[model samples]
Target: MTDVIIVGAGPVGLLLAGDLAQTGVDVTLLERRDGAISNLSRAFGVHARSLEQLDARGLADPLLPTGSAVGRLRLFQTVEVDLGALPSRFPYLLITPQYNVERLLLERARAAGVAIVHNAEVNGVDQDADGVTVHTTGGSHRAAYVVGTDGHRSAVRQALGLPFPGRSVLKSIMLADVKVAEEPAELLAVNGVGDAFAFMAPFGDGYYRIFAWDRDNPVPDDQPLELDELRQVVTRALGSDYGMHDPRWLSRFHSDERQAPEYRVGRVFLAGDAAHVHSPAGGQGMNTGLQDAANLSWKLAAVLRGAPDALLDTYQAERHPVGRSVLRSSGAIIRAAMIESAVGQALRGFAVRRALSVPKIRARITGQLSGIGYTYPAHRGEHALVGTRAADVALAGGERLYEALRDRRFVLIGDADLPGWEDRVRVAAPAEAGGPLILVRPDGYVGWAGRDGTGLPEALTRLAGAPSAHMAGHTAS
Candidate 1:
């Protein structure tokens, strides 16, 4: 039996697979689709925190060069507001198509020795105390753990009897990637109608991704989409019949802001759209999924490497609230952009403009959009900062905590000598640099940090399985 079996070879699944493989776990990823589709542009932005996660896997440099860095996001209405004051190292959104993101992730997963079985749909799954037995089109496979990263209609989630509770927004959105002769100069633009909106983003490939919604017109799932119908909607929203030639792809999607009741059930877990689905208003879907993988991957690794099974509980604790927060923010964005009543539009427009005027409010919203406002709660008996992600701080070892964590190992920072723990951990002195000595996890999160090393031994014991007999001798200088 494999250590883990991940359903869906999307970005989140591939990311988890890569992380697990890097940590020496035997992982298998199943995908319904054979290979990457060229015209898929479902998601087009990766936020700052996702970039850091990608960097951890040594995949960011090659992947980033394939997309554009969009620093300014312009929200269009009767009045336009620019989001430029966000406080993040990646202060802007990176505009790469979802397909490219998946491509890069697949490459990294392969390099990490993750076995991917494509066109292998998971039909059902049965989990017990020992392991999970996954039934797929090809055959049945057993795994110690199973993660569902499939899209909205997740087979794994359905088989597990998880509740996807949320309401559909009752609007039909038409998305098309087309080569246009006369494209707008703005990197991103959202034109507002009475209760509807149309957004366009130039992908630098002589193609533009156009999304237009018809307020009060919700198409049923089985309904057919006509190209002429989408063209008319585009013409009405743009106020001009701009030619859309050589259409690469066209799709109609209805927004459903649904989320699973629980992220984990028995040996089965869910992440990405399988766990939550929201309106693609702020391009938060992919970023949220990537963060979910980042959070769960290390925990899974820890469990496989002999940490307490209780570590698995933290995944839901950390990510459930995050999913809820995304739901609230994305719902607001959808309402503001698609609410039909003139008064509602005017009110939302006023509110957005007024909110943007406040620096703190703007920064908060921007930080949320960039996925920089997330921090997990620390364990009670551990250091006050043990479970929290280490902030980027310069170390005496001539590297930032985040930079040092790229190797996917645990690091201990203190003034004390940790000679006995040197084989399993890296010790760095914080006083020699401008910041505190911090213990960093391979996932680029801070595991512990303190000046006095009050709870250092206990924290290390918990994270590293058990403490050595020499732990008592590694006292602070």
Candidate 2:
């Protein structure tokens, strides 16, 4: 049996498979479509935290040049969240097509020796106490664990009979990829009027993505899209469509704010759209999924490699709340942007403008949107740095914190001792005073921190699984 089977070869599944494969886990990835990268990308913004995950895998540099960066998020005509002021190395959002992210992750997954089977649609899943059986179009595949990243209409989720309790928040949202006669005022141009909303971003390939919706023009998803209608919606919202023409593709879909009741059921798990979905207002969909993969891959690897099975439970504990938070935030932004009444629009505009005017409020919004402000509950008792995102701090030997995490092993920065656990942990230079002796997880979150390595072994056992046989030790700071 394969160690793990991942359904859906999108960003989330690819990232998880790549990470696991990189760490020598046997992983198989399945996708329904023929193994061709699609030009159609529903997601655009790559948030800072997700970028950090890419950076940890040494992918950030190669992907950064593929798209432009945008530092501000416009809530409406007047309110803008300035991401440039946010903390961390990547203070702004990267506006790249979802295809760029998918391509990069697929490359990494292949390089890591993950067996990817395309055109294999997953029809059902059955899991017993021991393992999982995935029913696909090709055949039945067995694995110790199965993960479903198969999108919002997840067959695996349905097979498990899990409840995805939520409703469609927005409908008939029009999308198109086309060439424009002229550029917009900003790299990322978005605005909404009382009856319509529109957003535009470029793929850096001489084409622009146009998203527009008319509140008054409710149409069926299968209704053929007319360029004139798209032009009218964009013009109504942004005052111009930049002479949009020569459409490459056009479609309409609805956005829902739903989440699976539980992220896990027995040996089968859900991540990305398979677990939760929300409005695309904040561009949080793909980023959230990528982060979910990052959060779950490490725990899954540990558990499969002889760690206590209880460690896998933390994946849902830490990520479910983040998914809920994203739903609330993105739903609020979309509802606010879609306000129709004149008075309601004015009130929302005033409220958002006033809220974003405060420095702290702006920073908070930036942090939330950028995914840097997220914190998991401290498994280790309260330390100032516990459950916090470990910054890419400079350490001795000209190395950086994130650089130390590249190998997917736990790093003991400024450690004291881990006699038999050297195989699973790396000892590095001490962090700054406030963050001395920090234990950074493979996913880049601070698992533990203190002035010394006291209580470190317990945390290690809980996180990295029981350490392997003694290898070698490095001098502690």
Candidate 3:
């Protein structure tokens, strides 16, 4: 039996597996596909928050060369969110293929000794008080906990008898990755006219990803898609296809907004598309899933090491609400883009421009889009910074906050020492004097902060398992 069994080896699963492995957790990744990572990518945009998560793992700098960054993201040609204003080291979206991310995480997982079982299709899961038994096409495996990072039709979720609750948002959406004869003026172009919509983004290579939708022509997923149809739809919706041609890939699928009623069912957990999915309008789908993995990984690691079991429940409390928020925001964007009448389209453009002109409204929109502004729920009377994302503050060693977090240990930046928690926590002084005492979580969120060290021990108990001498975990300086 392993400590954790992760079903699916997509970016979400790979990241979770790598994280668990890094902290000395025995992680087994069960992938249905053969022992090969696909080059194709369904997600092309990596938001700023995801880049921060990668930064914590020391992968962000290495990933920069693999993709390009765009400071501005245009939506429907009428609305745009300038990512330059985001308060992050990675203030803009990275336009890399999803495979690039998976490749990096997979390497980390392997280096950390995560056991990967290829061609293992998990068909059932049986969890009791002790552990979870996952039944796969190859065989059955046991683990203390199970995580399903599978796509929308998650077998683990299905075995749990969980219902994905939501409705279809769009139909006959055509996807194509090809080389465009004419480049768009902006980094990204998306617009709708009348009953059709088309969005295009570069893959950093010669190829580009396109999504063209026809409101009147609904078709089945198996329906044959032609390059001519894709070109014509783009031309109708975008005024010009930018001379799109030489299709490298082409397909058609509908978009849906779905959220599982339960993110956790007993010892099994669902994340990524398994927990929630939504309209592709905002490009938030992959970003939200990566965030889910980041939140759950640390919690599971702590719980496995004897932290309070109730801590796991916070996964749902924190991420489920975020999932619902993404759905609402993405749904609103897609609905506005699908405005059928000319007057409605004009109003949508004008309203979005007007709303974004206001500072508060613009901040909220960009924050939601970039994912850097999200924070977990802080307890009553807790410090204001408790649940907020930890900024990359400078430390005495000429290192940054995220640089310290790369050790997979909590960095306590303040005037206190974690006596019995040296192995799992680190004490560092901020480069600047008079800084507030704060404990930054491994995932780069503030776990605890106070004027003094009065509640430090209690917080450590909650942060990691009861601190023991020289625990089996990584420690920063």
284-359 per-residue lDDT for model 2 (tens digits):
9999999999999999988887888998988989999999999999988888888888889889989988988888
Off by over 4 Å in 2: 431-435, 470-477
Listed per model in order, the count of residue pairs whose N, CA or C atoms clash below 3 Å is 3, 0, 0
lDDT tens digits, residues 1-477, model 1? 999999988899999998889878899998888766555657888888788777667667777787878777766446443444544445568887888888888887899999988888888899888999999898998999999999899999999998899988645778788877676666676675654567777776788888888765667545666667766776666664367778777777787899998999988999999999998888999999999998898788878876788778888998999999999998887766656667876887788889877888877787777787667777566556665655555577577666666656677766666654564477665536445557787666677777666767766666655544455566664
Better of 1 and 2 by TM-score: 2
What order do candidates take by lDDT, descending? 3, 2, 1
Candidate 3 error regions (>4 Å)? 470-477
* RMSD of each predicted structure: 2.5, 1.8, 2.5
lDDT per residue (tens digit) for residues 1-477 in model 3: 899999999999989999999999999999999978776667888999999999999899999999889898776676777889888999898988888898999999999999999999988899999999999999999999999999999999999999998988888789889898899887777887758988888887798999989988889877989998898888888788788778888898889999998999889999999999998877899899999999999999999887898889989988999999999999998888788888888888889889989988898888898898888998998999998989988999799989898878889997565667878888889999786789998888899988777677778888788977753443233
Badly placed stretches (over 4 Å) of model 1 are: 78-83, 238-241, 379-389, 414-416, 419-424, 428-434, 467-472
Clashing pairs in 3: none
Q: After superposition, how far is residue 429 of candidate 1 from its true place, in Å?
A: 4.8
TM-score of candidate 1 against the unseen true structure: 0.92
lDDT of each: 0.78, 0.88, 0.88
